[model samples]
Target: MNWLGWLHDFFTDPAHRSGPDSVLNRLLEHLAFSAEALALAALIALPLGLLIGYWGRGMFLVTALTGVARALPTLGLVTLTVLLAGVGDAAVLVPLTALAVPPLLVAAAEGVRGTDPDTRDAARGIGLTHPQTLFQVCVPAALPTLLAGFRTAAVQVIATATVAAYVGQGGLGRYVIDGLATRNFATTAGGALLVVLLAVAVQLLFSLLIRYASPRGARTGLVDDPAGSPALLKESV
Candidate 1:
């Protein structure tokens, strides 16, 4: 059958909709794995990032770690972990966590740094403590940048979570891997669609979240043009 025919079968088939190895189950697994990694990354990156940005310290550490993460190939890292640690979820999770961290860290740091200094000073003028200035004053101003980083990391994690299947774990990738092994091109194509759809969904979800969560100035696009809205950061504060 052609692509259109396969797609119809892929979506309509009851087996794909329900069963232990169903597409839905695999998609859930994929989501779970990606969420786990992203959560861990956020836990590690957010506090450190917030502190680094607030203190204007650890820039070198963040930059170096981010650079190393970006330079490391995902497939190679996954494979190496599997070889060194032996095949299992750890093989996949470690590398995936590594893959997810950089964006979160960068966003956290940049958002903190990008705050309007005058706004920060004004916050200080109000007798807000250091912690208060960082959280109440600066963090809100940095929301746009932080949200952008979060969205990027989420999309990437969803796309890459397929690596789980290679390590004998479940994920949307199972379809692709199994299909390829058995030469079932339709299943492989369907899996690809699922991954892409999930990634898009994540992006859309974050966009809406950012829209509602953002200060009005940022939602209006002032965040994109720093010079155009010098006061917007202060307004955010």
Candidate 2:
């Protein structure tokens, strides 16, 4: 069959749709894996990032770590992690979490840093403590950028989570790996298409969240300055 025919067959295959190892199941696994990694990354990155942005301390640390983390080979790190932890979700989580942190850290720090200096000064003048100013003033102002960062991280994690199948974990990637082994280009193409669709969905979801949920100032920072946000993400990535 031709490639399009393969995709149609892959989609129409009832066996691929309903079983425990079905595409739906694998997609759930993919989402779950990405979620876990993002949560872990947020825990590691957010507080430190907030502090760094608030105090203007450790930007070098953030920059150095972001660069080093991005440069780390995902497959090699996965291999080393599996060697150390011995094949399971933990092995996968370590590398995925690492993959996730740089964007989150950069976003958090940058969002907070992007807060208007005049607003910050006014808050300080009004007797807001440093912590109060950050939480009440800066955080609210930075909400949109923070959400945009998560959008970027989510897309990255979703695309990369396909690697889970490499460590014997179940996910959308299994189709690609298994199909490739069997010379089923159709299944491989379909699997890849699914990942792309999921990433786009995530991008759209975050865009909506940033639009309707964030403060006007926060939304303005993201929506009004299209060039700035991408540049920031580009630098981080």
Candidate 3:
């Protein structure tokens, strides 16, 4: 059958509706795996980024590390972690979390640092304490970019979570792996379609968040370094 025919059958397949490897089950597994990794990445990266960006400290270190992380070979890392971690979700989780961290960490730092100097100073001058200004002033201002980065990372994690199947963890990726192993073109295409759709949905969700949550007032047009901070853009210092 053609790709379109296979996709149609994939959606209509009764087996996909119920059972251990059902569509619902694989989707849940995929979401859980991706969400867990993303949550951890956010917990670690956001606070550190906010601190460093607010203080204008550790720019080099944070950017350098994130860059290195994004460059790492995800498949290779998963393989190596499985060798040491010894199977189960740990193998996939380690690399998946690693994959999700870079964009969040870098964007968060850059977003915070990119806050207009005037806006930050005004917040401070108005008796907004450091914590107050950090949370109220800076976080709001930095949110659009932060969300943008998060969107990238989250979608990436969701798509990449399919690799979990390699370690015997069930996800939509199982269809792809099993299909390829058995030379079942329909299952492979269907799984790839589901993953792509999920990624697009994640991106759409973040876009909505950026639209709604972005600050108003001075944050309207060129507000808060729309591109990024001069500090972030600079090669050094």
Task: Quote the positional error of residue 119 for candidate 2 in Å.
Answer: 1.2
Candidate 3: Cα lDDT at 182: 94
> What local lDDT does model 2 show for residue 57?
87
- Tell how far residue 10 is off in model 1, in angstroms: 1.6
Assess every candidate by TM-score: 0.89, 0.91, 0.89
- The segments of candidate 1 whose C-alpha lies over 4 angstroms from its true place after superposition are 222-237
Candidate structures ordered by lDDT, highest first: 2, 3, 1
Model number with the top lDDT:
2
Which ten-residue region of model 3 has the weakest summed lDDT?
Answer: 228-237
> What is the alpha-carbon RMSD of candidate 1 to the true structure?
4.3
Give the per-residue lDDT digits (tens) of candidate 1, residues 39-117: 8999999999999989898899988988898788888988899889998878888888998888889888878988889
After superposition, the stretches of candidate 3 with alpha carbons farther than 4 Å from their true spots are 216-237
Question: In model 2, where do residues sit more than 4 Å from their true spots?
Answer: 214-237
- Indicate the worst ten consecutive residues by lDDT in candidate 2: 228-237
In model 1, what is the error at residue 86, expressed in angstroms?
Answer: 2.3
Q: Backbone collision count in every prediction?
A: 0, 0, 0
